[model samples]
Target: MGSEGAAADRLLSWDRVSLVIGLLLLIVGHYQGLFVAPAEAMMGDVGRILYVHVPTAWACMLVYTACFVFAGLALWSGKGKWDAAMEASAEVGVLYNALLLIQGSLWARPTWGVFWTWDPRLTTSAIVLVLFVGVLVLRRVITEPERRLNLGSIAAVLAYAGVPIVYFSVKWWRTLHQPFSSPATVSDSFITPLRLAAFGMIFLGIGLIGLRWRALRREVERELSAPALPAALPTLELGQRGPGGAA
Candidate 1:
């Protein structure tokens, strides 16, 4: 095989390895979180959702931040690769963000007795979701390549402005959401699973993003290399002589 094929094989190998490691971590982490880790003194078993929820929320924001950086690079350098990275990261960010909201709601229903609330943290998170959703929708409607890239990058940057707000909203306002605490606050037993889940989700998210970026890059390459549609054959004027001078 050629160098390109070898490179593709290497990337695919890494993607598979990363996915396997991430899956294993998730399995071990979830098992520990559910069975081994001691329940919270105040929240009891309901708090177990923290293992998944916290990590997912972290991954969601992390990907969005990366997406924003990619967008900035794309806008500055006008590089299609950066745009591909931005698109892939945006997609992963949206997926994790949606999951974050779902996991929060699931935990909330039992803890707060409500599935939805108008709290600041929750509201900002919803905005984060809607903003990215709008970006994806905007991407679909724009047909021009350069225009789409420029506009989508701008949208990603704007959407990222909400991320820090989401993180700090709990602290900045009186809300139903709990403020994030340091590692010292968590028990040793709980720490293992939380850390495992956090790293696992990060690896999984990055791996998935890599795979998506590769796929998009291929699509862009195909689009660029594909032959343009042949110009429509000039229509013969009605009532005019044909090419052979036959009407």
Candidate 2:
């Protein structure tokens, strides 16, 4: 019990640390992007959105990738922690993916003069998001833990296949969205803030994932440890003999 208490304390401390660091990074990153970075000559201030937008997009994929890996691990080892991690990653990944689409739309309206298009990158991203959302729905509908875990893990892996497609669609197809593969293409001022925001988002995403996983783990533990309810007493039927033939 003492050891368990110590372990829990350590986890709590780590969670707080992660939350603080993640918040700090995001705050600083936003500051740098808004104040420190120079405005682009072409897009001007609108380009600043890239700092948050691109990072959110990157973090979405990163979290999903982690989800895929966690699902695989859970399935392979049949470990509960891995399932918790997978769930955490998937939920957070979906959130970031949603934000990515919104940010992309916002960026697109100003740059492309339209809120949306059937571009390959955008289409593939939407598909990925939908599939992951299906994973979440599947989890809720399924009641059995093992069954839910198995199905969700499989779905997570299947959905992850779309992530690479989304990533490569820009390169594979002629899309309106510009490929940002080369640092040389972006200005130094933009690069610094972009990197900062990227790190900030990465840290924040990871921290959230950790905290969520731990919370889920605790819930599972409590469910497992909880004593079962006492069995209900059987009622005597009308005109039926009770136990030992008593009325």
Candidate 3:
């Protein structure tokens, strides 16, 4: 084992720590938010939807941002390993976004009297999902590793550009959906576990991303190192040029 191997091991350790801490906080916060928080005056039982909606939304954005970060790294350094990380994070991010849409719609039906509406937040969120789904699909169509990476990077940046719009659409444009309110939203009798839940989701997203990233990194490494198949593997040969591998 060399210094590079030692460094990879340390990163692996960091990922494990993040995953454990994140799951612990998520469970603890979910319990408090769902069971312990007092019912609201206006929304009644439906108000408890806050715990689910807010956290999932937070995680969705967090994961997308991470995916974008990894995408940028892949494009900047021209490394297939970072491309795998980007793809992995985007898969999980899209899942979180889908959950956000479903949960938001469920909450909407009770409060708004309809299962679906064209609120800016909801509409933008739907667009976000479709955009990244395109990214995943595009990844499959390209057989060449380098071309796939470049296409994926472009998709990531374009899709991520919509994230801020989705998050702030409610704020920027007057909308039926309530503006987001976390610790900063209230000051009376409602600041404890809800705040914890928000932070909990943050950590949880971080941990999940780390775990997926490391796993995907290994997968890309294997693909790079694997012996050529007898006949099935496509001859999309990637080569090192100008220097040893990528800088």
Candidate 4:
């Protein structure tokens, strides 16, 4: 028990370290984007939103991808860690997904002249969010730990089907959303901050998932280790006498 606790503490320390590094990187990246990077000829300063927005989008997809992998591992190995990881990643994915939508809307209102539209990318992204949220809801409604893990894993796997569609939607269909940005397409000045922010989001997400995973792993361990309750004593009929009563 002592060794296990120490190991857990060590893991938590690593998570904290990742979080601090990520925060520092994000601070630097956002500062460069806001002050150093030149404004776009068309969108002007508003394009700066992409610094955070693009990074969030990347991290959100990556987290969901991790959730899918964890779900598969949980199903195959029936391990507590994988189950905990799946839940953690799903929760973080949902958070990032929410942020992605809000950021997109903020950028959209100015660029597209509306807060939202049924563009393929936006539609698929929203669906992905709802699907994972359903996974969380299902986990809550089920009480049995093993059963919850099994069903939730299955739900997470199904939810992941939407992630690829979200990624490819812009390419597959006509839409207001732009295609994936790259060195060839984007200006040299924008790449540095974009890469910094993207990596920052990735590390930050890892830290968040790790912290949540630790808490969930402890819960899983406790549930699995708990002794089963003794069977209820058989109830006596109204006319039945107690064991020592006269017949």
Clashes of each: 0, 0, 0, 0
Q: Largest TM-score belongs to which candidate?
A: 4
- Cα lDDT tens digits, model 1, 34-105, are 999989887899999999988887778789899999999988977777888898998999899888888878
- What are the per-residue Cα lDDT tens digits for candidate 4 across 109-227? 99989998666666677888899999999999998988988999999998787667665765466555566666578998998898899889999999999889988988886775658
Regions of model 4 farther than 4 Å from truth: 10-12, 165-176, 226-247
In candidate 2, stretches whose alpha carbon ends up further than 4 angstroms from where it belongs are 1-6, 9-12, 166-174, 221-247
Candidate 3 lDDT by residue in tens digits, 1-247: 2675576678457667776776777677778767877877789878877877777887788788889998999899877678888988898888888988999889889988988877777777888899999999998898777788898889899889877766576545745665557667665545666666667767767776666776777766666454765765444535653333431
TM-score for each predicted model, relative to the true structure: 0.83, 0.82, 0.79, 0.86
The local distance difference test score of each candidate is 0.81, 0.79, 0.77, 0.86
Q: Is 1 or 2 the stronger prediction by lDDT?
A: 1
Off by over 4 Å in 1: 1-5, 9-12, 165-173, 224-247
Encode model 2's per-residue lDDT on 92-187: one tens digit a residue.
Answer: 998888888888898789987999866666667788889999999998898777777788899888888766766576546755555653347886
lDDT of candidate model 3 versus the reference: 0.77
Ranking by TM-score: 4, 1, 2, 3
